[model samples]
Target: MGGNLQAEPGGIASFSISVRNTGNTVAQHKLTCASGHGWPVELGPSQSSTIDFEPLDILEFLPMQVRLRIPPVTNGSPPAGEVDMITCTVTSSNDPTFSHSEYANVTVSELKVFSTELFDLQGNPVGPEASALPITVETGETVNVSMSITNIGNIEIPLSVKLQSANTDWGMYLVYDGVIEYDRVTFNLLPGHSTTVQVTAIIPLSTFDGSQNAFSLTTRLDEVGTNQFITNGTNFLVGKLLGLSLESSGEKVQATVGAWSQYSLWLNNTGNGALNLNWSTAEPPPGWQFGIDSAPKSIDKLVSSEVSFGVIAPNLAAVGDIEQSIRVRVIGTYYNDSVEVFIDLELTVVPTLHFGLELAPETSVHDLPRETQGQIVVIINNLGNSPGGGNLSAIIVDGEGVEDPEWSLQYEHSFDELQPGEEISVIISVTPTADAGSGLRTVEITILGQADEGVIVTTSEVLSLGVTAESSTTAFDLSSIVSTEVFFSIVVLIPIILFVVVRRMRSSAKIYDDEGESLVAPGVHTSQENISERRAAALMEDVEKEDDVISGDISQFEIQAALVQSIGDLPPPGPAPLPTGLPPAGLPPVVLPPAVMPPAAAFSSSPATTAQDITVNIDDNAAQGGVIGSEQSSSEPMPEAGQQNVAIAGMPPVPPTGLPPGWSLEQWRHYGAEWLQRHSGK
Candidate 1:
């Protein structure tokens, strides 16, 4: 064991011992130590103790640290630095008393790496750790610090020390103790040597951090590196540090170009002493102005203060990031060293949006007409601001029973952008069916949104409409039908077609002359022979009165009336229809007088021949007597004194002769025989 230790009275010194197993086999050994103090010896400064080693691998060294404590001198105590023999014995576990002994030449000395004095720059003594150090100063102040380092080894060692600080302005240097030469130097001293050196460290200002980090001083020996004889450390931070920070500096501020804004800044002095700091703003945007809210002079340590500022952006500040900074610098010559704090003022510029969206109708409520479409105008106003663009559309509010295809709505409007206070108009057209009953109709108009405009559509509102039912008619409700072409084809066109067909059919029928040759009908020549042959053919056709009434033929009725008079004057068959205006064949109609003249008077020479020629007239006067009345005269000539005649049925008898001045005597017998025989069915 090799160690040189120092101890004060009633103190202890420590040393280490290495036990190497040189044998090839693994062995177990028991370690024991004995000293001449005649007390229990141990590896840890005890007078007597047992140290059992575990199984030792081959060629491995099992090292143990042993300590020696020296008691104060008594009547029988050894003097200081007197040699004490500490014999450490190791015995193999397999052999009894098979032991080996090693001796430790221990001096009764306390741990004394340095026995010199240490002083600070103010001539005050300093301690050995981060606890006791040179006095602290305020921020931005350079501090003078001095300390000494001693070489505790017997051989000479190279010495160097550095101040560990991140501050660029902090300075530190050292010099050999008790020498006027202040330049840095290293010396190799003789054995059992000791030397003193002085050191200086400059503390930086901005170090009042809560992360438990501070500027420190460490020493280094050239030969032994940083271990062994170079284990000197000192913490330069005293009670607190000078620090300044703005609480609101971490977040960004938003504004538009040409707009002014204000911000509240909080400054905190987290140090233990009074502080003096000077701050300024730098790199502001062009044409912009900046001002402090409430600037104070200084701050006491550990105290927090508040400050406010206003920044007015220029009318030409570009729309992007504006790089700016706030610098807080401090210098202290009293308690804490110098500090410099910087916070960036990142100004983000954007466009101001003050647009307004609304949907207003021309009227509050719309009253729609039945069976027709209605329209309303909606006003869309662009109460604009800086700049933005959006779209506007209309939405119909769905009401109960309003889901029919007959009810419809339509509209679409879009404005890319508008000037300040610009106005726009839109129209919403609504259509209702004919069957739309009396009720209310609701529609909603809304402003639609475009992509990335940041405009929410809150302009939806309902538009109500009152409707009325249609009038009652025999017409059918064809609202569910596709069209009205089918109704016109059946109701109107077919009736017109039937009237044309009946008029054409009546014009094609033949009409006969049957007014006993006095009144001639149409479709006859003026020749009497042609008239007689046509008349005979018309009579032989057997005209029926039912045919006249059913076929709506007026000329057919005249034919039936003439056949009735041929039997006898039977009151002209109850007024047969006479063709008026133009005839059905487009001929001029013939008009007859109220009486018929006695025919053949001019044609026959005697009254008997005229009486035989007397025939019933096919006119209204034929219903009269021989003198234009219904009665027949008795003093009448027979049909040429021997001709046979048949009397008509439903006829009155003839009157006696000597009738009137205009009477024919033989005409009475003609009427009697014909009227009686026709009535008797002969």
Candidate 2:
């Protein structure tokens, strides 16, 4: 059997045991102890024995023996102060055979005490001067704190380390623990080797701003089967926060009128920073105006600069200068500033009259008929700005260059303001006296102003007038009547004289033959004798018996022969008559019929000479009238005597006159034809 025992320092311990093999056998046995715990003992076969030990202040060792026994073996427990024990035996059961037995003994003792030393994962000794781990971190960042746990003591010891946060709200935590057990980690150290441990913590956004925030790290060490030890660290930070301005100006100057003028003003800026300004001017008022003289001035980066006219700073005071001037004598109130300030200049206002006139339907008349009326349109255009208040007087001069007091016409008008370029129209009617002579006439329009004491401004134009005499129907004097009668008597008598002479000449020519010998007055060559003879022949022809006459006393053939003989000569006499009943030579054939005579009583009072003379005078007058009116009037002469001839000629015969004063032959023919048709009808 073997045994183990424990004891405190300076302690004595003992143990006894008995072994018996009831079967008849022989046995062998041995005894042992651990190295530090010594034992003095012997063992015999089939025999049991007792062992004894003394506790040492230092650790001790012990060994055990094994035993063998025959059947029916027996055993016993170790004595007090033993930690453990073991025993063994072997034997034959049937007969008393050989047997063997072994046993072990152990002693308990106290270990020597020593101080512990710490080391890191690198196996480096961690002395009492070791410092806590340091860490730096930013906000919202996590940092890991790594540490090693080691045993620097000469004895075998179990150790452990722990990690924690001083500020729990700073997001501190443990990342790893080197100890596999609880606070009591099992470890053996030779005063050098070590194991690493790590702890981590997270920093949050709320940890800091533009200022510092702090946190702490804590670590603890634990001895095997003992209490804990602790250490700590601290960290801090600073924070920074992030910053943004916005500004403008107003307008100024103006101008007005009269003559020439000038004005000025300023522009200013009020803002956080300086500004660049650009400006220009619009066209100015009626007669006077203002303008920007030069370009716009600029200011630099600073609101105030010497280069500019004025400093424009934030809420700073500023002032500008304005110069104004004028040239003409201005009349109305002049405005100088935005606030009411008026100034008037010395000047004058004048009033005058300016006007013009035009005649409508422009024409001229040398002299107008008596009681003639004419229309005269006068356009009086006012060429001035002011109104013209005036009286108008029109005087008409006669055609004889004389002014008629009764021929004047006049009118008046009081006009309101006739603004620039305004006009008025007037129409005048005039009638001239019947006695107005023929020449130029004048109509003068005098415009007199009411305001100027009747001072006149005259404008005149001329019209020509023409006059002609009128005809009279009845009014006459005795002298004019007598003179006109005489003139008519002379005109009649001259033609009558001409006709008588022509008749006498024609009679003479007809009585003479082609040889210039009178047919009836044989050998008498005097024209007077020839006329007497023609009269005698005409009378003889008429005396032929009335019964012998055919187709009246004168036939158309005879009339034609007479006309031809009167103008020139007849054709030569024809051949002698044919046998039987032909006409005689040079005579037209006669056609006879039964003749009828007038009653003897009807013929009783008819004188043959009277009838013959009458017929002769008629024939002479007819032939002379036709030829004289046709030709030869100038050759005829007036008769101074011979009343019988004049009486026979009847009405003294119309004179062989030239054509009536203005009448032509063609006109005579027209009248003659009309007369013939009328007479023939009768």
Candidate 3:
């Protein structure tokens, strides 16, 4: 009989058996085998060989062995059983009637096992027991650990793979066949087959440097009523990677000239450790100023910081925007590694223009004469931050609140291209007419400046001027004493006063005799010494006649001087010296009889009279008779009957032939007597 046999699945099961010839007679037989489980059965070592048995031999026993192979589990394989039988048959090759058979029992057994290992991405082994090895990684970095799983058992099984991390900050994942699974996966594995599953670990940026993390990968049966089988794990350490990020609050900045501008900046530390940051600038525009609030600051890992800076433009800066750059550096305090970043900045400037006027204290108020000129000096200033130019002018007004036509105003300064805080001096000239009286006056000066964008700015100032007189001292002014009309009338009245005084003194004079008896004649003037009483009446009539010669050329003083010279030459009138007393007193005593008067018949009939014609002979005693005449001398010549000759001494000569045409003959004969008459009248 075959002994009972047992075998594992997918392995060999063997048994030994003997077969005798049951048929009588020496017949040839074939030896064959059959299995209950439908397993492959071998009759001998050679599958095609047959065993011969002696036909009915007396007590002969032939030994034969059968081999059975356990079929691997498959979709078409029969169900496994606790026990199975294998039968061996001996049959006659020549006679089919004589055959014999024998059987053996077989049993099936299943075995399951698996192994695991860890490798790097390059397929190199990590360590003897991959769980004890440590891996280095930076923050925010992803690393893969290759895990190899092999099934060493005699059966195919489904498995569940899982990845786990020791630290919660690390992210774990499992990848198979290019598909990622979060920390766990399920798949099937056949016996004696190998596969690779990727275990990935991700480090967070917030993780600190030098931090440690442990990663575990485990595999187990996926079937029901099975426990986990294999486990693999690894360790990771956080490394230092220095990083920096710099950002500005705004990209553009606006500013004015000579003014300050401000902006904000933010610095972020992206490294796994702390860092020291330093900030600086490149070359800027000339005369520009910079101000920073915080510099060279320290920042922790994953932390951000904010700072502010200021910039001031120059006073003479241009009116447009400019570009500049700034740099920030991260000094690695952990690993001595550095990083740098540069940022571009923009600047803008604006223009402003303002003006002012400054007046000197002395020029603000002044005293001026009407004829003299006055001047005022002032300072013009630019008070803003731009370069500009404009116009300048002046206006004047008097105390009566009206523009004074007599007052003139002028400014000799022209303003152009003035810089900020620049100053210029201006002179204002003031002039007044002669008729501008003493009063107060005002002068207003104005300055205009052109600002940016065609805007105008103006400033003005006013000054006072006091008018005064030309002379300073008090004195008599002859030039102003009288007007021209009054002076000419005083010169014309001085000549008429002298002529009336001389005429009254000549009319009160008289002629006297030696005994105080006035020389007298009957009805005749006594002042005539050279003419008889008979010619005095004719001289008085001639002196009264109107003549042209005496009115025009002759003066009264010349006529009076001639009369005085002619009268002084005559002797004063007196009785002739008594003829010798007793003129023929003896002869008169002898015969004193009255002498007889000559009768009127004895005179001839002629009107002409002379000294000789009127003479009568009188004896020495003729005074007793009332007759007075002298004896005519014999040597005296006689005059014609109608003519007479008269002569006078010390008189103006006349025409010798006759009287003047306007004069009568009677007046010519007595021309010498007119001087005597006028002298006696005065």
Candidate 4:
């Protein structure tokens, strides 16, 4: 048998083989088939390795079918274009060399199969076939991957390669040989051949830690209507990134010498992970101190913590603005690297002055009498940051706003400089004169200082110092008399003196006209000269009767004396004759000796002329210049004793007494004249 057959992988190759009894007849023959490629071959329907045929059955040409199986690709199938031959043998059962053989050919066709593998640039397998593990990479790092694609098919094909990424912002590319292919690459591959491709992936810095991304390589035939063949992807894990920040609100700080100052700083974790941190500060200059508070050992992402730094300058540090540098270092608790921040701070020191003035508690006020001296104590303090220089002044001010020439105020206390927290006392001797008379006064005390900036600082306090009217040296001060008894005596004596003055005033008011007639009431019956003559004659008759009895009473003598004195002062009646045997009307009366007169006999006899016989007139000479009562004419008959004179026209009724209190004869005469004229009918 000679035949040709074709089969695909894992398919069957079938053909027919012919055998004839060309040898002597009636003998039995056996049939058998062998494959050249060691594949299984079957000869007949019995499916035995060898089959026997009879001579009668082989009389004519016998036809037999042979079947050959092609091997699968996974089981080591032959390559494309390879051929396999099958040989069938016919032999006599009894003879070993009496056989005839026939051959057939089997050809393998094209079979399409593919495989892929992945690895890093260092040849570490990281593909699906190798457990499909993910690749870990840090942010901002580049990764190179190798992709190997194998064609396990029986024929050649055009293949294309492409790289894909899960994120658009990630940079990915495909490469062939040594040249870069932007998105995809194409090439031809023979059966059972393999090719390598490079995949580049650039991780961006903005990627977050622990974020997952994927990159895949797709391989397919470059043919129309071909679906995507194979896609092998691997995950990219983003590693953790650590970040830190240190800052403050201000760089410069103010401080004074020998004083502690504190500053604040903010420490923040700005990265995408938690961190354990330690902080420290640099050493300070000589004689300066620096300190820092305990900081947090662990911090979470996006969290902030506050830290404090304290500093102090030495006592001898220079004044004015000074600068200092401070450095802060922060280190990770798990790492050795550190971050540093610097700050330049300023410290200020200047001279200042503050003054305080206070009066001593016990000596705040003084009660000084007139013509006496007193002392006032004032306390002054320098309440400032530095040394100060100034002067002190004091003055006495009267609350009543009265200035006295005899008042004196003197003090001698001054200083050129004074240190801080120092105090001093000053005495101001105040002497008030006798004329600086009484009431409240004040001692104004002031202290002034100058600062380094030429600014004035002053303080003042007002103290009360009273001046009493009492005098220490003067024995008797009339001005100091304030007794209730003396006041009452002065008030009672004033009315008695006023009464005497009023009586004398009335006596001086008498008036006489040119004819010696008193300027009395116009309707008066008597003239002033006639009344004087009647009074003188009546007084002389009383004295003569007393002399006949020779009364020794001193009261009678006093009466005679008073009569003598009163009549002697009156002007002599004008050109009138003297009554016979009587003394001249102007002559003074004779007074008997006191030894000859007896007190009991003086008032024993009652004279014919009583006090009622006498008539009196009152006058206000300053206003009217006339008396206010009536008088009898020289031709009128004399009224008898114990009888009143006849009532004249317009004359008022007179009192029984000679004169009323505070009334004079002239005033009574003028008034009586006017009264008689108005009441002439009555």
The best candidate by TM-score is 4
Q: Per-residue lDDT tens digits of candidate 4, residues 353-440?
A: 5656666665523447655677677776775556677667766655444343456767865766767778887777777776654445
Global CA lDDT of candidate 3, please?
0.57
lDDT of 3 by residue, 251-321 (tens): 66555444456687777776556776666766666777776676646788768787676776665455666
The number of the candidate with the highest lDDT is 4
Give me the runs in candidate 1 sitting further than 4 Å from their true place.
Answer: 1-217, 222-355, 366-377, 385-390, 399-407, 415-417, 431-682
Model 1 whole-model lDDT (C-alpha atoms): 0.49
Better of 1 and 4 by lDDT: 4
What TM-scores do the predictions have? 0.22, 0.19, 0.26, 0.32
Candidate 3, pairs of clashing residues: 25-55
**Model 3 TM:** 0.26
Per-residue lDDT over 18-69 for candidate 1, one digit per residue giving the tens place of the 0 to 100 score: 7777778887888787766753345743344577777888888878777666
Worst 10 residues of 1 by lDDT: 585-594
Compared with the true structure, what per-residue lDDT tens digits does model 2 show for residues 324-370? 22221111111221111112121221233345556655422324454
- Going through the candidates in the order shown, the clash numbers are 51, 57, 1, 33
Q: Cα deviation in Å at residue 444, candidate 3?
A: 99
Better of 3 and 4 by lDDT: 4
Candidate 3, residue 335: lDDT: 47
What stretches of model 4 exceed 4 Å from their correct place?
A: 1-4, 9-12, 16-27, 36-65, 69-79, 94-98, 120-124, 127-131, 224-228, 240-682
